[model samples]
Target: MDTENCTNLYLQVCQTFLTCKYDDPTTFDDLYKLLPWLRQSLTCCVCANVIVDPMSSTQSHCQHFVCGKCKGGKMILRPQCSWCKDAEVFETNQHLVVLVMCFKKICQLIASSPIYEHILNYDQQRKKELAAMKSDSPAKSDTPSKRKRPQRKFARTYVTSSLLNIPVQQVLQDAMNLKDVDINTQPPTVECKT
Candidate 1:
């Protein structure tokens, strides 16, 4: 069978595997049986790593699984398939992309549950402690330390119809057209005492 057909088959199989309803608690043995080709097929050509990102390109003649990084670098040197030298534009495997996205969402859902809250909190606290330690370190240089400049933070302002006295959709459409808003124009400032 052709590469495209094979990819479509994999897509279908992956979707089924992902959507399987686990009634009784079972192991990965059942999943492996359902989708035998999952492990072998989902791999990068260059790095040989599992194609978790899924945004990959299939060369026309070569039919190799070229990851985005490998494809990009190869394109710069020669605009041809790395394996077969086919000059046609590489076809994007959208099915793989969708499957990877679905997998990521599933992972996110699992990670955000109450069961993992303690682990997440611990990780955040560790990061904060590390940052504090780094900031507390004294400068080793004998030269006078220069005064550090304060950083400016720019924030996006989301306006509503009630605030602008116009329809929200209309305001959004107008904003889209006025893309070249002058950056030098400063927002109105309000003074307050602490």
Candidate 2:
């Protein structure tokens, strides 16, 4: 009816439409279409109020909602209708965890929901697959196969001018002496001064 109500309804309606078409959200176009509808449907669930500013990134992108009762105060996602805080609601009815895992950061959460369960079903499935693979492993073989060929000798590389044979520091010192010979060694410089 009002702008807020319109936004919430718009959200539900847009979700339904996009879901019907392609809810998989494989491409940007689906998200684009949904976003416009999402913005239109940006209404508060509690007071049936329209969201003028849904905070960061706007109503379409952000999920935070405001109700008329708290006087423009913020509340958690999907809170109780009457009170901004979900104190009266039972733990199972109120609590829910959203898990998001990335390459390095693995996020997990505990949720209390009277309606739905949140155990990681995929992890259990993966463990079962690993166990099956372990069980189906091939046994080790003891007997050697009758395969032989002419063996070539392996030649090891020798260090001819190594530090052990000729001290590298001494060789460098000798080279330095060759470059910088004393004046007594006979290549004397003649200084001409006025």
lDDT of 1 by residue, 33-101 (tens): 323233334444444433433334344345445444455333211233455344233444555555444
Predicted model with the maximum lDDT: 1
Q: RMSD to native for every prediction?
A: 20.9, 35.8
Clashes of each: 0, 9
Worst 10 residues of 1 by lDDT: 154-163
Best by TM-score: 1
Query: What TM-score, over all chains together, does every model reach?
Result: 0.33, 0.17
How big is the positional error of residue 27 in model 2, measured in Å on the Cα after superposition? 14
* lDDT, each prediction: 0.40, 0.29
Give one digit per residue, the lDDT tens place, for model 2 in 50-150.
Answer: 33212121223233344223334434233223433442221111001110011001101111211002122323544578789989999767786588575
Candidate 1: regions farther than 4 A off: 1-28, 34-36, 52-59, 72-92, 105-194
